[model samples]
Target: MGKAQKNKTVGRAEMSGVERLGLRVSAMINSPRAQDRCAALIHRMEADQDADWEEVMSRIAETDGVSMVFQDDGGVLLEWEAPTDEDRVLELGEVEALEVEEAPF
Candidate 1:
């Protein structure tokens, strides 16, 4: 019984970062240039490379505290503990609603 209890906790399913991201991340990422300038620069640098996982991590390490980590399944994660004024979320970013066109008379 003790082993079964322990196993249950250890084997619990977890939500990967991508799964957690889902639809919410779309707005946050495209929040009208709300991304931190430095972070954006880092993102561009990574995008320009053909580097592998280790290389990406190494390049990201050059930045102060920002990091881009990819999950085994290629889910990306960007993390930075430091929050400067520019990084502040002034408001919840919004996604535009779909528009429907009326038939012409």
Candidate 2:
């Protein structure tokens, strides 16, 4: 018999300003409402153009399902509910496509 596994109920992460910006961009690109706006911003950011970080952070914080807090040291604390078992299963399937390519065939 296998031991029971404990479920994680919440998740937390601390990120630097740049990392938080990337996370916000990822979330926006996945959102139906924000996708169109974020696509242009992504291109500008990637091209080292004038994409303001503060403005980006403010916009993302206003989006639905996003909760953002800025730290005094300019870092970010992100918190969210842990994925349920059903969500975990779907994510695991996606992870299978992300296998590392370091091994020589």
Candidate 3:
């Protein structure tokens, strides 16, 4: 992946006992939910004063398929398996938007 961007550190030891060594995670992060989740991670790093970094890694490691990529410039990149059937339903063969109700002031 472009020499891993030169300064990125592949998270090999982010989780001691977690086996995410060679998991193949998609480099694409174009999905809305995926992007939102990554943004939340960044926001957490910025706003959560008492955030547990390792705990966060561990929680992610606990997921079925996951990986971590840390950039040299304090940027955190997450790699996770696409949503499971139980986690999300993607076959939108037929979908209809519901009307929203306005709130009373």
lDDT of 2 by residue, 54-77 (tens): 666666677665456566655544
Off by over 4 Å in 2: 1-51, 86-105
Winner by TM-score: 3
Better of 2 and 3 by TM-score: 3
Point out where model 1 deviates above 4 Å.
1-54, 85-105
lDDT of 3 by residue, 19-83 (tens): 22112122234557775564222222343223354554556668666666776765457765656
TM-score of each: 0.27, 0.31, 0.35
Q: CA RMSD for every model?
A: 12.9, 16.5, 15.6
TM-score rank, highest first?
A: 3, 2, 1
Inter-residue clash pairs, candidate 3: none
- Per-residue lDDT tens digits of candidate 1, residues 23-44? 2344444454545542221232
- lDDT of candidate 1 vs native? 0.50
Flag regions of model 3 displaced more than 4 Å.
Answer: 1-51, 84-105
Q: Model 2: clashing residue pairs?
A: none
User: What TM-score would candidate 3 get against the native?
Assistant: 0.35
Per-candidate Cα lDDT values, in order, are: 0.50, 0.53, 0.48
